[model samples]
Target: MELLKTLPAKEVIYSFSTLNPPVLHIRPGDTVAIETYDCFKNQIQSADQEVAAIDWNEINPATGPIFIEGAEYGDLLKVTIDELEIGTQGVMVTGPELGVMGHRLEQMESKIIPIKDGKAIFNERLHLPLNPMIGVIGVAPEGKPVSCGTPGPHGGNMDTKLITKGATLYFPVFTEGALFALGDFHAAMGDGEVSVSGIEVPGRATVTFDVIKGKHSKFPILQNSDGFAMLVSAMTLDEAVKTAVEETIDLLLPYTDMSVSEITMLMSAAGETQISQVVDPLVTVRFFVPQHVLDSLDIQLFS
Candidate 1:
């Protein structure tokens, strides 16, 4: 295993682009411990800090564009999140013109939540269990540079709460070495990220990387104990949901004897169309299919 620590002065990127040089190189099957800054780059340390004081340029700083030896174009870069270690304090921010309810009357506010014994102390009356997840994670895109705040086929800030420990995320390798990087740790977040922020915190993610030659998904695929989910992002929630359903059907078609209509019906019956986060530049959605459903059909997603 190799460790890539992110010191305060360490270089972090706001976008996922081939233009960015790789900070570290490793072969397939290697476990890397990547340290990361919070979504706000740890600038909002106290509740008294105003959200407007933050440098908008450093909204989401991903740790590294780590180069994987065997990853290449058209291949799949498989990343298994082995573990996540977050800091003691997490921050949440909100204000007018910020999130889903931003238009409502509200001034800028920042909250510093303390983490203790695996729970986030939301307030004096409520303690929520921590569900630490990686908010920004991706490889370089095939096209132009993409902001770290957006989620797309190349994965960026998907903000899916499911991307926690024990989950395996597969990203399409667009460039050689699959220049991958990640940051924006959320100690706890809900679906849709309705407030534009989670319990944002600095953390370290331990992950194992492997290259799956040739085969890759149209979008990223997240696999966890429950099942497999197709991660898709688009300009709008409707578009994202439509694309996710279409891609999910495409993925299942080849593995089953069922016709498109039958598969569509099956999906409607059992699959779940869930939201990741709507606050990003591009909204992300996931179409999930349970393991039991696949098992019943004798279908295996990947060889």
Candidate 2:
């Protein structure tokens, strides 16, 4: 096992660019206990606070550029999330120009909610069940640097709620050591995150890493207890969904005995797709096909 704690304002990567110096190194099958800050860098404190008051440059700060031993370009780095401990409070904001509902707003609005009894206290009259999730996570991109605010093949700020505990995220290793980093905790968020933000909060995530030899896929894949999902981000929801389904088909082909036409038929008949987020620079769509469906065909996702 290894350990890596974030040094607020330091030991963080705001963008996935060329590899950063490794703050911690570990071999495959090793476990890491890491700390992360909220998307706003844990700076905003109250509902009355203005969105413009926050520093945009320091927005979504991920914990590290962790170097995984033996991870190389074109390989697959498997990150199994073991645990996520969210903070007691969170913040959600909506700016006039910032979300799906932004056009409906006349002024910037923000809310600070308290979490207790497993609920997000939105106000004295309203509260909702807590569904904590990680908002940003990924490895370095192969090309030019990408801001933490954007998401692409390298997986930054996808804002996908499926990235909870007990999920395994497989990312392509474009740079040596993988240079993995993650942050932007959310106490809860809806499917599209239409409001432009989740219940942003600080949290800690414990994960285990493993490198799959020469098993790179076109985009990141997420496997949870329910099923296997292909995560793809694009400029539009339609494009994202298309790419996700296509990649999922590609991944399923080699594992099953079905031909391309048969796979396509099965996906059209049984596959489900959901929105990961619509607020980032790129929208993410997840195409999910149940494990049971694959099991009926004797398909193995990892193989």
Candidate 3:
């Protein structure tokens, strides 16, 4: 196992496109323990901090473009999240131009929430359990740089709450060594990220990386105790849903004898459509097929 420490300027990459040299290099099957910054770069530490004073460009800093030995384009990179530990407090902010209800808001707002004994203390009367998650994670794209704030074929800012501890994420390898990076820790968030932000905070994450030669995933795929989910992002919710369903069908085809119609039927009955976030430049949707459903069909995501 190797340790990759957080250095706000160097190791923390702001965009997936402007690929820099890897801060650290590790081979497949190696474990790496890394630290990540909050979406605000820890600039707003107190609730009373001015939300309008933030620099948007400096938000969502990711931990690395860590190079993995032997990981090449057209291959798949499997990352198993061993742990995601967050800080005692997190900041959630929103502006008139953000979120589903952004158009109705009058001005910018911010909140500093403290986590105590596993719950986010929203106020004196309301608290919710902590569900720490990774909000931004991806490999460097093949062409022009994509901001850490958007999501696409090359995953970035796909604020899916399911990306928690004990989940395995599979990303398509577009560039050599994958050039992977991650950040934007959320102490807790709901589907759709309806408010345009979650309990954003800085944290440490431990993960293991491995190479899956030859096979590639067009979008990110997640595997957890409950089932398998394909993370798809697009320009609109309808398009994102369509892409996620299509890709999931393609993935399920090789393992089942079910015809297209039969597969669609099965999916309609056993699969679920989940909204990741609708706030980014691209919308994200997740298509999930339960573990029991796959088990019944004797299907496996990777052989």
Candidate 4:
């Protein structure tokens, strides 16, 4: 298996403009490490940089292009979170997408958090621990490419901070080599990401990869170490949530003993689903089930 020699900060792409994304090469099971910078592309580091220095054309930049050998269209790529380090100074702010998002900034607040012992000091006033998450991660689409701002089946701007270590993310491969890229590291982000920002910081993170041949997924789903399944719904808040709940069942059934019919019956009887976010234009549904329930299941997700 070949390895990624290194991930350089200067090599990171500052823009997103494609449908058939650029190819990123990598082995299926290899772990790749990356260094993340603050979302403003070093605005904070420059001290003189304006808080709104982010030009409309240039915003969040992701570090990647890791290719998975043998990956092809109609396949599923599994990404595992291994490590995420949040910088000492984290910034949270109101995003320009607010008016369109129909949410008020009154409830929004700016915070500077310090990371120590894998925890966050939300403000000089209080503490809010976190589960560092990659706000953007995706591959190219078939025939066309997508931007880094939109989170979809290809995975981008998920903003789900709970995608911490020990979780696996599944994405549909729409191109050869699965041109994967990721950026926008958030120290901690609230649901719906209403303010359009989180504890945006730069740090070094690690991830492992797994590839499944001849299988595809409509959207991304994550299964946590604790037996919880999260179905991500992106686009239109309402649609995002509805999509997440339905997909949660899709993720749950495969890991359960119940046949498709049985699973349907169980849902009709008493099933559970919870909304994880509504602000990212990406909603996540966390399906909780006991290990005993998954123990006897013969189901499998993705096909």
- Model 2 spans > 4 angstroms off: 1-10
TM-scores for every candidate against the unseen true structure: 0.96, 0.95, 0.96, 0.81
List the lowest-lDDT window of 10 residues for candidate 3.
Answer: 1-10
Report backbone clashes per prediction.
Answer: 0, 0, 0, 18
Worst 10 residues of 2 by lDDT: 1-10
Task: Give lDDT for model 3.
Answer: 0.89
lDDT per residue, candidate 1, 125-172, as tens digits? 899998999999999998899999988899999999999999999999
Compared with the true structure, what per-residue lDDT tens digits does model 2 show for residues 1-303?
Answer: 334533343578899876578787788988887788788888788766777877878888888888999999999999999998999999988878788877888987778999989999999988899888888899999899888888889888899999999999999999889998899989999999988899999988889999999687889899987889999999999998888998899888887788999999999999998998998889999999997887798876666
- Candidate 2 yields a Cα-based lDDT of 0.87
lDDT of 4 by residue, 90-187 (tens): 77656344523534344333455677666677646667777677787776655544556656676776666657777778888877777777788887
Estimate candidate 1's alpha-carbon lDDT, on a 0 to 1 scale: 0.91
User: Which candidate, 3 or 4, has the higher lDDT?
Assistant: 3
In model 2, the Cα lDDT at residue 87 comes to 91
Which of candidates 2 and 3 reaches a greater lDDT? Answer: 3
Alpha carbon lDDT of each predicted model: 0.91, 0.87, 0.89, 0.65
Give the winner by lDDT.
1
